[model samples]
Target: MNSHYSVAVIGGGQAGLSMSRLLRQRGVDHVVFERDRVGHEWRTRRWDSFCLVTPNWQCNLPGYAYQGDDPDGFMVGADVVDFLEKYAASFDPPLLEGVEVTRLRRTRAGVFALDTSAGRTTADQVVIATGPYHAPAVPRIAERLPAELVQVHSSQYRNSGQLPPGAVLVVGTGQSGCQIAEDLHLDGRQVHLAVGSAPRAARRYRGRDTLAWLDEMGHYARGIDEFGDADEVRLRANHYMTGRDGGRDIDLRAFARDGMRLYGHLRAISATRLDFAGDLAQSLDNADAVAEGIKDAIDRYIDSAGIVAPAEARYVPVWRPDSSPSVLDLAASGISAVVWATGFHRDHRWIEVPIFDGRGYPTHERGVTGCPGLYFLGLPWQWTWGSGRFAGVAQDAAYLSSRILDARRQRFTDEVSWLAGTPTETYPQVEWWAAA
Candidate 1:
């Protein structure tokens, strides 16, 4: 194995693969390290019925965009794995699988020292593309629940059959939670969903796919600085919806109409009971408002473009009782399972650097970190709203690769100057293009 490389990409997913492809194009020497097979999360973390929320057209890598017949259709988890595998195999990147990057730190001489499961290696540049979601983020209150009750995260859940027999309480209203609740409910399990402030979204709006419209409007490409509260926008909950069910709406209101019991946020868990916040109705209203705002934006776009389009019908609001208790006795309700879908936090514990902000997210100008020779990719709002998605990482990767190329050029210039007895100060210093 090569102990040294110009760049070391710390992942094997779309982000890392795309970065590697761009680096290779620039004639940059690099190696990709993965703890498991390529696209490990798609192979393991996702549920059995998992599918990409974005359509096939949005799944773009560096050299390979989705060329399948179903451009509008969503790819299932296994199909995604196949796509990634083919992408990696096609280029045959210098990928070292089953090699976990246990630790990464910058040496005194400014090179990255990576301690991996395979062996130690050094790189002049390092790109952390491990993605946003790392560990399951169940609340600490869950530990107070009874041991008999099966507690599974969305990552651990496969099918309804895997869960013990009884009613299930899914403690989230994000995309994953909504989809999982629908799956379990449709499978004949009594489902109770804990609604939160997750926004609702219409899968299609104004005679076009919502995602397509957003792309057309440059919504996805909006930089973080464009927002008033950048952190708030970055940390905003994903809208409640699903690409399954033929792109039908799957918000909290939809779930309630489907006979699924809805509750507020999971506040606490006692020995045999669960306490919820009394804000279900308010939460649903907030989600509906967001949905309306999105549709309004689409309508404005149609008008601004002078495109003739049919008016879309508005969704009817679902009603709930004004007075509902804020508590549930889990034992009395016969709830045997709790599926926590509270989302995930990026685990950068292995990194010993000061490039992180107060929230532990990497502080970067695009993918280039404040620390020279270190970078991050596939992070939420890393550059724009789409920074973390399949459609966006390629752009960020290309930008980062260009920066690396500039650095490589400078390195060569310095080496030649040193060998010729020329003063290093006489060498021309060229600045790389800054991300816009």
Candidate 2:
């Protein structure tokens, strides 16, 4: 292998693979560093009957599309891995598998240095394509649950068959939690779903994908700079539903209709027991209230902006029980399993770059950071509606590659001066809270 490349990509998932392919096509010398086997995270996903929320038509990498007969059809988890492998193979991406990047720092000569298990390497540019879903964010309250309750993060969950045979309490209302609850309910596990703010559910309107419509209508595609402040974009984006389509269309509603009890956000877990904020009816009411707020926001946006958005994008109503149940009541229900599908957090302690914000996320514009030659791709909502999706990665990759090429052509000298006493490179140091 070459001692260094013009660019080094620090992931090998769909994003990294796609980015590497684009760079290769541009005749840019680049190498990919993958900590595990190719598509390792997808292989370990807890979903059993999991399918891409996005249609297969949108599953294309930079230069490859889903070659199967069903383009509009959703792909199963295994099929996704296979598709990614094929994509990587087609591009002949220079991938170093099982090479974990332990540290990333800037050298004195204005090059990025990467320390990996394989060895140290230097590159003119670095692309951090490590995805948003790399780390699972489990709440601290999980420790309070009894040891026998079989508490697990959604990442560890596979299918209902892998779960303990009893009533299950799913502690999130996100896509993963809803799908798992539905699956467990169908498998005959008395399932109870703890609803946080009910998520905006995806629904098809007319004959188009909701996301496509959103993108065309400038819902998510609008830039943060286009809006006055980041807060507005964040709020509007939060109102947008995740990729989950519908009740019958997706699995969450099916689980509810099939008799999965719904609860509010988990308050506490007592000895083999769980406590909810309110009764199911009250929880459902709370969910309804949240949905109403989202609807109002969407309506206001349409009314003020005069944008023709999807009409059938309605929020699914939570299953409202005729009789409300009591809080702190689980023993009588026989709930034996609790799945935490809360979400994920980014941990960049191993990255020695000072460009990261206090939240540990890299502070970057599109892909370029304050530090020259340091770039990021595949961040959630990095560019537009398609930013983080498999299909969307190629566009960002092409754009970033062009930017890098432009920078190289400009021959711009490094304007940011290094501190006099500061070391040229630094080792990975754990953040204070992370160490605790």
Candidate 3:
């Protein structure tokens, strides 16, 4: 590939590809570097039954919106990979697959230099669009689990048949944990779900998809300021639901009703036994409270907007016995696999800049980093609640591309003025020089 580019976008996912499309349109010279193939995570990391949590209609990238037949339907894992591949093809982006960017730092000349698997590359500007969820964050207790138990992260999980011939313990109560638990339970495995504090939402509310309601209410457009706390919004857990089973809601209560074992958060794990907290009832109550809050917000929005909507049936929380044991004999339960759906953490160690916050997150103003010409995209709550979603990454990408272009134009103007031995203040109109 090229040794130099005007801009280098790391990661060939939606964010990078969207930026590539916009940069191409603006006559900006750029290249996209991918550690693997485009949409590598969607192609490999996700499970077999995985589908988009969001609707198909919301999968909007720059210049590429969802044109498939089913706007409301959810796309499966492979279909998402195919969509990304087509988007990459649409622009013929200068993407170098199998090239991993190992190091990113500003050189002495004020340009960003990247050390990659292929070779060294330099750029005037760099957009780190590698996304937020970089690596799986399994709890330290995971290491103490019995060696015989097949431990797998949610990303490595593909299908129920991959696990050994026994029950599965799915830790965490977020989307992945709930979906995987449902998957295993449906596949005839006696499933045990360790519950956490994840809010639940009905897939459909008041005769419309919940996402559509959120879109109409501009919930997706809400920024950290709207939430009143950046840390709270950034650290908020995703709701417990799924787009699988044709967008059916995966109620944890429903799981308990279906004869699946429910446990509190996995506190400690010994060789033969696993200890859980006695907060199962409280956890369920918290989930129900949050779920009610969401429904109430929707109700208020409907009333405020004066929209004619039918009353929707409310979901009742599933009740459990108050005297359940906080400890379980893992050996007797025959759980041979442990699925850690504990979410992910970002690893920005390679980035030599000091823009990270106290939580190790890159500090940026809607994608532009504190360091000039350095940017980030596909970050959660970067600009809004939807910033990390498939549709929202492109919005950040488009905004950042404009910033890069503005800086590029100014630099070109300065160069022309300096070459002509004219003062930049006097020769501000250098359109002809830029064109030439």
Cα lDDT listed for each candidate: 0.85, 0.71, 0.86
How many pairs of residues collide in model 1? 0
Task: Give the Cα error of residue 78 in candidate 3, in Å.
Answer: 0.8
Residue by residue across 77-180, what tens digits does model 1's lDDT show? Answer: 99999999999988999999998999999877667889988889888889999998998898888889998889999999999999999999898878899899
On lDDT, the leading prediction is 3
Candidate numbers, best lDDT first, in rank order: 3, 1, 2
TM-score of each predicted structure versus truth:
0.94, 0.82, 0.94
User: For each candidate, C-alpha RMSD in Å?
Assistant: 4.2, 7.3, 3.4
* Overall local distance difference test of candidate 1: 0.85
Off by over 4 Å in 2: 218-220, 227-257, 279-326, 412-436
lDDT of 3 at 372: 90
Q: Write the per-residue lDDT of candidate 2 for residues 1-436, one digit (tens) a residue.
A: 5666778999999889988888888888889999997879888965877767776777767789888887666777788888888888896889999999999998776778888998888887889999877688899888887667788888888988887788888887766776677677667788888876544434344355554545555665565566566533432323213232321244343456767776666887676566677655654555456555645655675668887655655555544465544464556778777888888878788788799766666778887899988888887667765678876777788889898888665432221222233343441111111233
